[model samples]
Target: MRFPPPNPLTLGALALSMAFPLHAQSDPSTAATLAPVVVHARGADEAPKDLPYSVDVVDGITLQERRLLNVEQVLRATPGVNVNSSGGANVSTIYIRGVGALYPMSMDDSSVALNVDGSPLSTRQIAIGTLDTDQIEILKGPQGTLFGGMGEAGAINLTTRRPTREWEGYARAEVGQDRQFLTEAAVGGPLTDKLAGRFAIRSAGSDHWIENDRTGGPLSKPRDLAFRGSLLWDLTSRTSALVSAERHRLRHYGEQLVLMPYSKPASVDMDPGLFQDSRKTIERYTLQLDHRFDGSRLTATSAYTDTYNIAPVVYDGKLQSALGRGSREFWNVDEAKERVFTQDLRLSSLPQSDVFWAAGVSYSTSRRSYDTPRNTYGDASAKFRDFDTDRYGVYGEMTYPLTRRLKLTTGLRQSWDRKTYNARYHGGGMVQTDSRKLDDSFTTGRIGLSYALTQQATLYATYARGYNPGGFNDYAAQPDDSKPYKAAKTDSFEVGFKTDSADGQYGLNGAVYLNRVRNNHLLSYDSATYVVSALNADTESRGAELQAVWRPGDGLAFTAGVSFIDAQIKTAVHGIGDGDVQAGNRVPDVSRWNGTLGVTYRKPLPAFLGLSAPVLHARVDYQYVGKRAADPQNHFDLDSYHKLDARLGIANGRAEYYVWGSNLLDEQYDLYGYFAPPSVAYGAPARGRTLGVGVSYTF
Candidate 1:
């Protein structure tokens, strides 16, 4: 189905900006002619533009222009962002500003907080693995009052397109090198004048790009599918509700690069035909009711999520008999299930000249289970494990105008959490029922002040407290002796300035922040016994970020940003000491310097050129990632690299075609972390240069 052309409201506005005020010079005899320019438009709840904070918004066009498949690739150009991968198509570890989940081995667990469509989605292996999104917003710094719990450092909010009143649909298909083929589509329209709905689906599968020279065979085949739908009902002029649901599944026969940078790295490559098998599925359902009265708003949100993961992990060296006397194949098979339910209610008072406020209450409960059914070749057998956690929180924030130029904002959150863990097995083949419970409550607060220094500039400073709740270990532990972990906390202080000139052609924002973390969590493996576990250690991180955008002329735009980090362990508590990680030691995978630039030009050709000819459009972009460490030991470092990606295409409004290239330089770099027999560095080598073409049509 095709819909009418978009309304001219937005186009007319842009046209006016272009034609009438092309320049500031006219009637050169006495005076200059300058047209009226619109200044910054702040949101109802938006803080002062000059608040001492750094926030980045990546919109829909930018996401598609870059052709990034997932957040992992999209965030590569984001300053202070870091990633660690195990292998191709495997688990990816994410960190922002030197803070992220300790370590994630499977689909049900992750440390970073993920918020989707206004609902909080906890960090999970699968959550980050698959996302067909609309726009991504990354807020840097401590966001304790609003997001709570996992928002220790900040929050990653992903906004998906909602239903529209006009009937519209688009579909795209892509094929490229490495046998990569994918299809994605979305359809939406008004079911009735007062209601609208949308449906979307995406599926993709790819053959392993890397070849196992020893076996002369491909290592894996990757497959994925996702379906989603949402509906909006306008009950009244001031009241409406939305419901959304999504299901995703992934199956693959893949490889894990267990050895890296070894003198004989090739010797560790297992036969390509002997790859591991992994599968995961996730389903999410959410409902929200929003009501507005007298410019004040109320919202209630509820969500349920279920995730299942299974993997038959292969170990080539572990299978090889120490004496070279056996030819048996060995592997570890593991499976886990997780279910989560959450509900929250929020009441926000629109910002007024005198006062603005927001208050909310939230409740969440989760149950997780891990099981290993069997083991082969003298490997330890798996046992059943289960954990349950419940959380309740109440939070409120108030902003008051102390003077015409000065404003103060204060917020507080009180939370309580209870966790129960049941471990069924430990070392020495001993089975024991070990159960433990923990109950703790704490309050977090934030204070911020902003001053409008001038019409185009503002200054702000803030101090906040952030916290992350601790829980029972995910993997092996003797049940009887286990104890619930304590909540980790951090104090953050920051100051900054932001400005947008009257011409509206230039904008600059920058901030500096210092953070001190108490009981920092670290995930590491035991050399003697290969179990990965989380440990609490003391640490601190400080950083600065600066961003500027300049659109000197129509069809010409430029953006540049820089980030510097100085993170370290403040005290020696765990076996790893302060000396082990010295001050000024760059955080792993976090580049001290990151930058990006892009140029785009689009215009219509002369009518003389064929009348049927499509419009000509072109774009080019550049990104740079500086050198950084890859391991906690801070031993080996990943070399800094620069990559260029370019795309040229033509579109008639309804149908479009484009050709693109990624990693144009074919730069080789590590993307993830892993443990090898002799190598401590853990990271997956990224892909080389590849070419592809895409076509899409809207009806």
Candidate 2:
């Protein structure tokens, strides 16, 4: 199932067509037009077309309409993003542009950064639930300058709904397949003429897909809970303050399925006699204040977040047996906490030309701790542990306009980290105990230039540098004299074009980027002791992507998008060679060709139907992932495959129902690896087709 490469122009056009309204309605006052979207990251109320970064904004209405349950599901249609879910739906991870943290070992090294309000959380596990969000902004590229210490590949900023001057609130309920139940409640109103408050709570849970082979019993679905509350106060005519807090919990029990050599795949249900369970918990709080001065403006933000996760995962999926079939049982307990504070002050009175600038400082500190306990089914003890790491950083960014149509932006940041490890071994007469510490620092900078080709078109070129501080690994086979991980760096160069119509009916954005990476860290296991070791390698990636939005007419719009990536190992050493991956090698989890087309129509029905206004929507989507190496040998490959999904729904003003189907063609494909012994232990499997009907009501 191989296909030709996709054209950027075609992909961009298609994305815009589906996203934008193409024509006006027949009624004069009911005409459909493009709406303006503003992003505060740039510190201005400008349209998405004016932002130089690759940004995707998913509105609240769209999320509700789609009945999106979690962050992973909401981001499914987004380009350059891949989500891997463990069988039976307990564990999930997101890879953005093939540039997310593969291993969640430390807090200092994250490829994709996430910020809720102003707080930087420890792990993606904290961002699992679906909430009442005002907007979700996905900003692409190296965000080292503005965010600092994190976001080497980019960042996702989630802004939750806020209280308003007017009283408003909504409560929603939903029921779905697998005995799934969902409930959400929200309230917002003015506490006083100068004060406001808002609160929201959501709870969802269901049954898992795994069925016990022996007892023919179903497992419990992971319990999901989320709660948020906020308050705003107007101190003076020109000053305001806000405080918000949120909490989430996810609890589940069970393990994934694995394949064994010379045997069929099997799911090793947990030993009920041992009484073992897994759980992940998260808590976060945020506070911010804004003040407008006569000559200068000052803004301050502060937040704290804590996360705890414990999973007794085994290296091999096979269960431990009396004969020792290379199977082992172990539990990993990871705990992390982060505290951040930020402030920005700017002077905006230009005496000469229409020019102004802003300068700010950011500071953040984090601590992480991990412990591993080994259990041979029933009689195993603790093996290794790492106490924690203390990390902090500072950063700033500024923008200036040389002319009305020409502007420039520059940013810089510096970060430092310290780590400590603790060990306890109980295999043989190996009494190994030691503690190591390392202090490292790195700087990242960005420079960009923009030009307005026309009122509706703009072109920009940018050069950005990204870096992350390395730290200690809990499991390294080589216990004696193992070097601490070192810092890694990447530099990117890019140029792009952006266009938007005067009426906002159509919009297009495209970029081509080349990134050079040094000291890239990779994991390898030692054959003798089966100890995992970290290796440093050099690599480079080059690619291009185009995304667009289109609005053809009232109740009619479409969107399409595409991307092409070519990544390879430039240099290799230590049992890792450069030849295994040649030029034009497609990066794993990234597709070479993908696109989606959709349309929606809403109109007034005839009086005979006894209905007021009825709206109908249908969409067709197709995505193709190219074949690539599924193993280190580079010989074994997973064939490329395509999937098509469609949906039809009817909605009125307050309540809506829809029948949705995914993988309509029932095409069988693998989204990730299919490991078979000696090479890798676990391989991700793609799910089959599913049909479901859902309805939602707001009161």
- Report the number of the highest-lDDT candidate: 1
How much is 549 displaced in model 2, in angstroms?
1.4
Candidate achieving the largest TM-score:
1
Residue lDDT tens for model 1, 369-441: 8766555644355667788878899998877778988879788999898877787763476666777777778
> Model 2: per-residue lDDT, tens digit, 370-427?
4445454432334555545655566666657768899787777776666666665544
- TM-score per prediction, in order, is 0.85, 0.84
In order, the Cα lDDT scores of the candidates are: 0.64, 0.58
Per-residue error (Å), model 1, residue 556:
1.8
Relative to the unseen true structure, what is the C-alpha lDDT of residue 374 in candidate 1, on a scale of 0 to 100? 57
